[model samples]
Target: MKAVLFKVGLVLCVLLSACSNSVDDSIDPETADDDLEGPISRPTSGYGVDGVYKVAELSFPNTEYPGTQVTIFYPQGTTSGRPTIFYAHPYGGEDKEYNRGLFEFIAKKGYVVVFVPYPTTDISIDHRYLTLWTGFTKAATDYPNIIDTKKVGFMGHSFGGGASIGLAYKAFTEKGWGQDGRLLFTMAPWYSYQISPAQLLNFPSNTKMVVQVYDEDKFNDHRLAIDIFKNIGIANAEKDFYYLKSSTVANYRYGTDHNLPNSRSAYDAYDYYGVYRILDALMDYSFNGNEAGKNIALGNGSTAQVTMPGYKNELMAPLEVTDNPSPKYTQSKYLFPCSSQENPRIANCN
Candidate 1:
């Protein structure tokens, strides 16, 4: 009887100890949202992750350009004058699958996201540019309440990035778009055409622009991005030349390449901090007059903009930011060399 009682007591003690440890291991629900100093597996704060507003999607036929389509996402039953963003996709990225998460993220945040996909097959760059422009203008006119034309942003990737420059130029010169507030977020852009360096000077000094380049990018040379940064008329204060660096944590790695921005293929911390966080802050600063967002968006090497918190209390590599980027033009290893492209409009290629 004594032996049985001792065995039972040992079992009970083990169970009680496990229960106590379990409670200790569990995260405290109340303080879970606070910033953690130690190892973390996932992002705790969903800054630009999801927003208050519910997303409502609309697709307008490309009346101006028949073969294309324009998709717009906005907050459901929202008020008028929502800050609008015109997004152009990368080359061959003719479907919303390329950036649907980002589009929904913006729309849910009470902003309008206009995604205009241009033709890649059997179409010239000029045709693609025109198609995007016409589709954008049509969407704005059709949904006047949803899209606030006065406060606008032009964002794109690769070929679309290059086109954003020309499109912003046309919109500003002709329609006074962004006279209220304008921002340009270009990522891994190719050789820009349809606008000259002199014409680049035509951009409003107040316009805010961020030219993002990836260190691992081998398609578009950094010189291409640097040239645009130098020639753009926006003052050094408003325009930023941003460079993303690749990071690794143990066995995992975050890529800083041309495809890193594409949320569909691979989504990771870089997308949240490097791309979404930066752009979200930028839009807020440029559109809604949010002064605090300026520290994160165009901080120009400020700690808020450069710091990218990662897992395991690890600080991801800081983004290289500056007004003037002196890229080594001779050291380019881009797959599409400047000399190889036939487009004569790219200023630096020749």
Candidate 2:
């Protein structure tokens, strides 16, 4: 595939709009029924070491059967409370292996991670929104001591990355962050989903971080993710995009058709470092309340240090095209709720 620049550009425009409007959200249908549902089913197999402990077969009560299940990876010994993160899996994947390596790495740094496995077979945006909100809320309330309810972070890959953005929107609009606030981080987000500009506009003005790993993914995902973040930044939205050139998060990027995965060595050396940088940034902001200052101290050099030829072209071409809208919000799964008969116009979700 040469590149899908135009589609990428269109996505940026849609997301920019979401940053401006207030999202209209209701109680996640899955959580409407009250019950302290337990964890989902455990993972059949995975690796965990030292401070890291992996627990699979955890289930959460949902509209679906056996409840929506997921996994948890965190430090083995935490004498005190630890920051909690709700980790969403990548799209088209059955488990959390897409982020397993990174999740375990973060766990060692002193944090609890809830690896959520959404019903991927039914990975519609709305379904994800409901599952994520319900699951996260359940974890916060049920495991208060383990999960610092006041400090929460969301990280996801691909479609899961997109879900992280939506979760941020919900957290902010619903005042879920009122006590201590929350952080939103997305890795290699699938920006093609058709959410409206109104729905996409709010994040830039709030707290968020998006990390894009450049590789050979179709839909020009890397460049498109950068374009989306740049628009948020230009709009003076509160967020930054950490760009990694030619370093796939895992060897699987190009190993498959998308060519986005990196080698195990690259994943450990480069990809893990990128995640470390982001986690450090987040920890500083949440604990120190000086994210901007921390970035300044670390120096922007580390933030955007990847040096790759043709990188500028890869970033600009797609941005140039996406600035204009084509597929539009109508194509996205986000349903702009209906209005009164007298006012047939439905307000944009932004």
Q: For residues 1-350, what per-residue lDDT tens digits would candidate 1 score against the true structure? A: 23432453354234323320022222223422322122323244434445556678889787545766689988777658688999987765677866776887687567898988765543466777888898899888878888889999999887788889989888878888888889999998876878877889778776888899898887677777777888788888787889888877555677786776765555666776788888888888898778777877888899878877766566678888998787644535875455544444444653
Task: Tell me the TM-score of model 1.
Answer: 0.84
Stretches > 4 Å off in candidate 2: 1-68, 77-81, 178-181, 192-196, 204-206, 219-224, 231-238, 247-267, 290-293, 296-299, 302-350
lDDT of each: 0.74, 0.45
Q: What is the per-residue lDDT of model 2 for residues 232-281, given as tens digits with 9 covering 90 to 100? A: 42232334555443322222221212212322222332332334444545
Number of clashes found in candidate 1? 0
Worst 10 residues of 2 by lDDT: 34-43
**Candidate 2 CA-lDDT value:** 0.45
Best by TM-score: 1
